[model samples]
Target: MPSFSHDPLSPKDAADVVIVGVAARGLAAAARRAGLRALVLDLFGDDDTRELALAAIPLRRIGAFAIDPADLYEQLAIHAGPDIPVVLGTGFEHQPEVVERLAARFRLVGNGPPTLAWTKEPLMLARLLHNLGIPHPQVFADHAPAGMRTLEKRIGGSGGWHVKPASESRGWGWYLQEELQGRTVSALFLGNGHKARLLAFSEQWCEPSEDAPYRYGGAAGPIRLDPSIEASIASALDAVVNAAGIVGLASADLMLTGDGWSLIEINPRPGASLDVFDHEPLPPLLRLHFEACRGELPDLALLTPEAAGMVRGAGVFYAPFSFEMRLDPLPDWVADRPPQGTRIETGEPICTLFAAGRDVREVRDTLARRRDQLWRDLSMASRKAAE
Candidate 1:
């Protein structure tokens, strides 16, 4: 049996809180530190991160948890816990039936009526953003936009899924016209309707894998967002937040153009880059999470982008190590000096290198240099082993 801690902090009162989809492990951890009785529930049971999950809850008062959403009813039936607050951290596609079944049982933050309605179709997200007046890339469906380059994208994809989903769903995929001419901006939104607040905003770049032509190479950080483009981006998303009645975190992808911004799509949950946002100590985003969990607005606002200049540069360096379609282990030299937020995955792409710098060039150069070093080390080691 797993050891349980019964310290005073555990949320003995089940009604106080709960969390779903263990992927939002960091947020859960923060909530626990704040004295919320949080527990993680996911389809996959405890693994190496379960300890991390437990730490996010009160020591002794940690509420009961279920392993999978499918097992939720069973788990709750057995524990007879309170109707705690639930935070959704899974992807847009993973929602659907799972959310519908549990909506009545628990209070789901950031999700309200119509939140999942528009997601049933592919281009609905883009349409919603456009209708809401947010600027984004020119969208093409069934045909390409006139006089511009276009890239295909899937309806409900995130991170690795971003490219793969588009490739597999070629015929039904939506096209993003390059001619729209705007920076690729992503926003993390919190709250409902007109009251929604923009938590974090940054640019994103998409890279394709060389070996797996359709597979995404992962994202690089700190895509430069022109200060002028914030208004267009904000206007577009506020409409969707109003329409959908979403309250938690919603990520919007937009393209800024001379004429206006075009809507790319919206992600209604915590995104992969959220960890990058956390490193900035932005108050609005942090305050939003706490406010949602506690049901009160934090008078504190996020630090201005200028104030966050101390840790100015940040980016994720995707592992490029591949051999005949298989991901290889990290070479000693590269693994030896792993950056602070570096993450390595087995049986997948090698790892993701996350680093920060004082400026864009500094950050980019640091990542480029580290990447080269990792490459050199790998080459030298291979030769030595071969000899």
Candidate 2:
């Protein structure tokens, strides 16, 4: 459990919303910008998350990834009260039935469990994209045909941590997907029950670990694509929204394969790309998400790229030690901050690094330097710890 620096400053009745997920800082921060007091229940009560949230409770998982729903539903009123709307995020993909339970108890604010159940099934998504005439890699349940180039992905997973070379998989709940050679780009969109609108796009990259080879590093963009391709992706996304009955904020991950772009996955809730697309001249995304769920999408003009838009990027910097190291001070460019003096384990994420500039390289370079600095600072701290 994450320790709060202090007790919640207000009673549960004061919260305007409650968010639940593996990580909820970004959602809580968005709520704060929308002038709403958000109570957060997640896997981390990081310094900034606790600060942004009116109250933050660290939720326990039943096993590896699924949040213990009984714990979450039980924690709800005691932390944020009965009537507060609940916004779901990253951790729910593998456990949509828990989503069903939450909806029965609270005013569920985004895609419901039925939609999730339909969309998150790996084979179902592959077939749906194929049925829609949208290009998608072939999905294999038992095995990929002999000599087929493929990769194994967790059945209902996020953060790309579950992806690995097909030869490395032990199967079970995993499925094999034909390998597609290309970079990944995501379209963050608003779905108003019937249709969806693309808010922005971002190119994704990974920071591989020995075990989690395709672990998601971060995303950076509103990157440009050919007009024809953009139209096609938008069309495909709309078809998916209508077909899946998707609602509120979601992102479709598409990869540019040799044949063309292939739709890979649909995150039925707000995702990491929010660190890129959520900003002004745009209304608060958390607010837009609420309105969209209520059956209204933001006017497209408000999202025009020329209005205060610029290339920006965010990257995740993981702890670089086998031993624990206390984070001395939070850097200015960091979000998802663990408290000062908190020890982060080797291979765990320390904080999210942000940078914005005239172009991708500028932001990329700046973020690289930030990571280098953390690498050095944390190294020195590790040495001191050993001493």
Residues 1-387, model 2: lDDT tens digits: 333456555536667888888888889888887888888898867888988877788888776556887788778856755477889888878877788877887888999977897689988887788888988888888677888888888877888888887744566778888888998888889888788888887888889999998998888876777778888888888899988889999998999876479888889888887788778766788998999899898777323345546777899988777545465675778898876556677788888999987777788888889999878876777678677
- TM-scores of all predicted structures: 0.68, 0.93
Q: What are the lDDT scores of the predictions, listed in order?
A: 0.50, 0.81
RMSD of each: 7.3, 2.9
Pairs of colliding residues, candidate 2: none
Query: Lowest-lDDT window of 10 residues in candidate 1?
Result: 57-66
Q: How many collisions between residues are there in candidate 1? A: 19
Q: Which candidate ranks first by TM-score, i.e. highest?
A: 2
Q: So what's the TM-score on candidate 2?
A: 0.93
Question: What is model 2's C-alpha RMSD?
Answer: 2.9
Model 2 spans > 4 angstroms off: 1-10, 62-66, 167-169, 301-306, 323-325, 385-387
* Model 2 residue 41 CA deviation in Å: 0.8
What's the true lDDT of residue 15 in model 2?
75
lDDT (10s digit) by residue, model 1, range 165-253: 22122565333433445556566666554455665566465545543333432233434455566654555556676676555666766
RMSD of candidate 1 to true structure, Å: 7.3
